[model samples]
Target: MKEDSVLKKLSRDWRVVLMVALVIFSVIAIGPHFDENGQFATNLQYGLDLQEGSWLQMEFQAEVVTVQTGQPLQEIAANLSEQLDAEVLPVGPDQIEVRMPMTEAELRPLFEQAGAEVVAVNQGVSKETAESVKRVLDEKVNSLGTKDARVNVLTGLNGITRYVRVELAGVDMETANEIVGKQGKFEIRVETTGDQTQHVLFGDSITSVSTPEKDPHYGKWGVSFTIDEAGAKAFQEAAISSNAVNDPQNHELIMYLDNETVYSAPLTVELANSLKANPVRSLTATTGTGDEGLEKAMNLEIHLRAGSLPVDVKVVGSGSVSAALGDYFKILSFLAAVLALIVVGVVIYYRYREPSIVLPMVMTTLAEILILLGIARFIQQLDLASIAGIIAVMGTGIDQLVVITDEVLHEGRVPSPSVYLKRLGRALGIIMVAASTTIIAMLPLALMDLSTLRGFAIITILGVFVGVLITRPAYGKIIMAILSK
Candidate 1:
């Protein structure tokens, strides 16, 4: 058969054979389902936003004595840390400290309130005990498979008492409470000491949250509001009758963060409409319990409740890789490539009289492109440098393929096809010189800090490499056969 004879002639070239082999090899390297943790093995790295983790803020009870021992500062810190079994950061030489979350169960409730004393906290670490908390944090980091993260410790002062602060960056809301600044559980039964027992309630009942303009003249960050409709009327009555006692101390609505009076101020503004009409001019609204008793309504049982904080964060720095830019870069690279191809194609066509001789190398150039992209997606971040490398590799492939085309098909220079191999040797020498110069030119980008530009340079150097070494020879072998045809 005439077709069988032509196919048999083409089959003699090993280039076609090797190209098929590399394709099969690449498929095996990146195919199939991967486990969650095993996804790391697939060479697709995710950014921090893509990863799931947590941010935490723990607050400690201000005035609490755990042990009866009247020990010195160092002894107290050591004993406290030992009790919690986590990291304990002390505020000063005298008082105040913190307990970072170390375990899932470190914040569970333990006991219930009794006849006006207080309840006990259950199976969780307290500032009284927790020494190896830092180790737990380290283990958590290692499990994430990332080296990038942020941590900070701070102290808050009020001219009266100092409070401890801790901050960990780049975490989602859900995981934050685990690293609570304290064992954020307080259950105190009250009798108001020698005078009248202070109103003790949960901090979890803040019906509304807002930054209100309490005083336009005193420009400062502040939040003000009235309770829900039902609670508002009751709070109004309590403030009206108690308005005469106006002694700042007794009239003060003491606010606490886990049982510490962070704020204690006298009832000032009186909302009269709140008492009669459930004023919907309501600065804000919150769903409230039906309790209309003055004490019960005003006792806003609330806790900061591991709520989201007001810490402002912004993406001040970022690197974006636009596919549009990629396409434009690709087009630019393509133009340069097309220009290079035209120069080589012109020289080769002038030299090789047969069109059949030039066609196979053109096909080989396309194959080079597939191989370059496949490798880039496998090994490194597919950035601009990789694109540059791909373009460079494509150009070299065509250039060398042109060389093979000329040497093997030029009827004026050769009588036997065997002599054509010698021309390939000289062509390879020329490729080496060109590739070396390109690689040297790309070296500066590798050392530079331009995040966007580095990827381009990296790809360029690698492309020149593959072109000079493996691809050139493979292409040379294939086109050598195509030219012989």
Candidate 2:
């Protein structure tokens, strides 16, 4: 009869049903399993701080400058590029990006010579260039097959990105640095008569690579690139010698990055005819049609650049954590979480002096944490800062549960169901306000790339939502039933 009563109560309460469903789903998401070595494990990922890894923070050696000029924007950019021997790009109506490091003093003279005056200079790249740099870094890191790697661009409020942070797990500091620092060697080759390829030009011969774009007329995706005069001449000679101009169908152009063929396609009839006439400085490599074409075009652009960032970067900070130290930190973080829960339980017991009340509060708080971790298993990696956020969540969870308990137990007796519902609504109002405040405060940290604190802020925000939306209401329902009895 008692078991039936408990089942009936759970069935009657939607809050209980939702909470139980979430708990079961969370447990499955966590996926606790034994390894081949018969050791307990979980699907929860750990960040660099919790695993053997190295991290590097690199600053771009470039600057974004606001300029006032009477000259044409393209003319000013061209003159500046010539004078500084670096890539100069116009970012906005009055903003120009210099792709090499130069001080105000060094750039002031060049601006005057180019018929432009420097309004202000900031040590960073434009947002677009920063994204390109980030993409290049991602491709380079991923090419190494490093399973766990992250690249984050740190942008400022003014839309300038000054720094990029990279973290690689299970990699030593030396290897990590090498992987990031090394540049791929790219080459262009022409297919010979019988399954043979002859090299035309190296990556250094390429001067510029444009972003992938779709041809409006044909809707085919392709990347445009510009080669130096010598490279163009060499390419023409290779095509003519290979008889690709006369028999374009049998001959194909192959692009290689680090000796790996990244793209291979036959020359168009127009391109072959043009090559037969003269060297072409500008060339486009068509991938294909549709989304797959666009994807391939983007990859080809990366290959054409040979893993070179649009702006140079200098390592400003770097560090490593040994496997043993990471393991120790992981153990410490686990102990801290366990200790926090125990302390919360003890304090709740001291306040209520009832095992029934204290146990439910502590258990509900633990359930909130479990759900948070389970969700994080898919979207986040546990680190020292995130663990601290988990502890903070525990603290906040207990405080909110106490509010619910005290509100329901007002006048030292359970009220009627109608009054109980009203009090629960009021308690939830308080928790909503508190949760909103916390979410607001952490919003900036979560959105901004402030190193490790980003993880801290994100985990804290997730925990608050889980507590306010899921666990707290369920706790209210559970405690109401116990107090009513």
Candidate 3:
């Protein structure tokens, strides 16, 4: 009857119920199952160490500099671009991101000539440009239909990105090289006589490309883009020479990306007439109405840039892992995790010499791991370092649980309910302070762009929180119930 009452009491306790519910939810999230090939699988994602993959770390061939100019920042960027014969993007009120690697000495003269003072120079691109490069790489990877890929921009404390890392799972080194190196060649050509076409401009001439937007007037989907002055002149000349402006239907304008025809349509009557008058810098390539058109328009927007990154990049480091090696690492990582749990359980059992107390500690620690993994499944991919972190968390979790056990069992006698509550509160207070210290120490690693240690730091911090907030508190309650009897 006492045991039944204890069970009923724990069931009613919100902390115990929450812990049980979270464990069930975590199991579902992990979803341990077997594939058609009889291989075990789960929703958890593994990093390069446990997967056959290639990783490339590329450095952007760009420089971020602080410039102080009496002229407007945008105008300084434009003038610097023209003077240096490279792309210059404005980053801040006094910062210009030059898309070419130039040293301080090489840039000082140019800045002086442009009526701007070079305040400071750094060897990287702005965060925005880094993100743009990442976006382009993501598009390229998606186009190739890679199953799993990750692109990360490694920024520094100064808020400049010097390197970007690419990881592609189940891909060989050579193929990975090709994928990152390949860039689409986008061309605009006008049909002259029957099928013969004359080139008007290349993707380099494109100044800006916009997202697919529905035309308010016609309800058609289109991508609006702007070209430079030179490109506008070339486009107009091609239209006139090809007689496209006169015979808009027969003389069609075709857009090609990597030699594959993407958009082929005659010049619109209005556009043809306008081109006959003068060069038009702004143009819109319209697709037909509805879902298909919207999809095509989105694709057209991607092709318009021709896979051009805002700044060039050079591969600084690269590595590949074979399937056999990855499998070996995976096995070792699994064994390490299991060994950690076993060692922790044995140590706890030895310390308490009581199954009731030791079992709850081990079980509570396991619950913390499950909850961490469940949350990680959706947010972070586990790597070898992450496994190490899990082990570390297991150790820390046991330490905290032991603290609770020792505090509750002070003087080797069952305390009254009021005393138990006070002890539990004191134990939790210690755990919270320890957890705070761990979190504070790990904050830099978690927030900084250190790709390798990020997973480890994040998982450790999460485990600390789970222990302090959920599992440890519930364990205290359950142990009190058992001791009270």
Candidate 4:
């Protein structure tokens, strides 16, 4: 084939190869979501570890309830703390509560352990039933869009009930506080595009929402929404208003929340219960699948986008990335990376006794860094920790590259390339163990509830593995050829 034809062929077919590789990579990156009850895909989630020190904050809210019979305030407070799995502090002798760093999932079990119930009136509960209080708490916790959060309990004044406090971290403070304010109230409003129109849609009917193509042809993205019965009624009414508008220009309804535009478009076909009849079905996986599995995910993603809370966010407590701090961190990181390169470079010189070998090691080291930065931007966000990790891996790669380089350049006097690789494999086995140990030690922390720490651990582990697996080998191979010349 002509070089142009070959290039075109590669360009044409590269997507297939990339797709397959990406699918595998995505599975490694986001597949863990499928194993969870939520069926979440981590594909789009920027792990905090990857972007550590970007922004972080924690906010606290307090929930009040009545005291039940048979428990003193102090005991009840203590009990509530245990239920919430947080430390309770006595705000007052007769009333007290607590706060802990527990996530949302840990609350109910803690409540059950405390033998307290969630009461409605915020008043006295008979000494009789602690189960109700816990059930209420459990219900509320489950209803919130989170499975992880912090909770605590306190005694109420006048023997009214327990006061509970929840602490949320790793989210913007404004949004988090708004979420707490909502108390998990599922609110939906159906409204037409204009005050003159009489159509609407409700929250319950929304089976899902999709932007389908990340970007649309019109320069404006289109979104599809599925409605349940209650939502269908509201949507139909809103559509009817659109139909009522005699002016073609007015023949559309808009969706709004808190007096702000969310979705607005012309009302076309009306559907009965099922969204498959809707014209935009082709773009939506959730609508066409008939699988309820996607419904919750769609709802969650939609609610985050359409609701008050943002699906993506800015760091809550990233008060100021001190130009001073950034400067300091950059200097240290640069020093460390340079120091590593120098050490590796010196080692290669000591081992190979030639400038040819040393030069390639330096090139391979720089190449690894470029590849790491590219991966961080496209595949994930890069933070200081991950940068540190990448630098460390680069240093490690130099040593391995030196081995492979040494092996390859000597093949004429030694064995063949494959034979040299075989000899190199023994050392690689040791390298693999070292890399594996680092990755294994990081697994638990990578899986931590602390998103930043999780990102740090994950990216670092991946960086080390990538250095050892993909980049190191290729770099070493290329470096070996150059050195042999």
Highest TM-score scorer: 2
RMSD of 1: 21.1
Clashes of each: 35, 0, 0, 34
Runs of candidate 4 exceeding 4 Å displacement: 1-56, 59-196, 199-254, 258-319, 405-418, 451-455, 479-485
Better of 2 and 3 by lDDT: 2
Q: Estimate each model's TM-score.
A: 0.38, 0.91, 0.81, 0.46
lDDT of 2 by residue, 1-485 (tens): 76467568867999888887888889999998999999777888889999899999999999998999887887888788887778888888999999999899988888887888899999999888888888888999999798678889988889998999999988999999998888899999999979998989999999988778899999999999989999999999999999998898888999999889999888999999999899999999999999999889878888999998878899999999999998999999999999999999998999989998998898898889889998998888888999999999999899999999999889888899999999999999999999999999999889876566989999999999898889998998888877766
Q: What are the clashing pairs of model 3?
A: none
Best by lDDT: 2
Stretches of candidate 2 exceeding 4 Å from the true structure: 11-14, 33-40, 190-199, 212-222, 246-252, 258-261, 264-266, 286-297
Off by over 4 Å in 3: 184-276, 282-303
For candidate 4, write residues 4-42 as lDDT tens digits: 653444344443334335435544543345535764334
2 or 4, which is superior by lDDT? 2
Q: Rank candidates by TM-score, best first.
A: 2, 3, 4, 1
The list of candidate 1 runs beyond 4 A from truth reads 1-16, 27-316, 319-354, 409-414, 447-451
What TM-score number comes out for model 1? Answer: 0.38
Cα lDDT, all candidates: 0.44, 0.90, 0.89, 0.47
For candidate 4, give the lDDT: 0.47
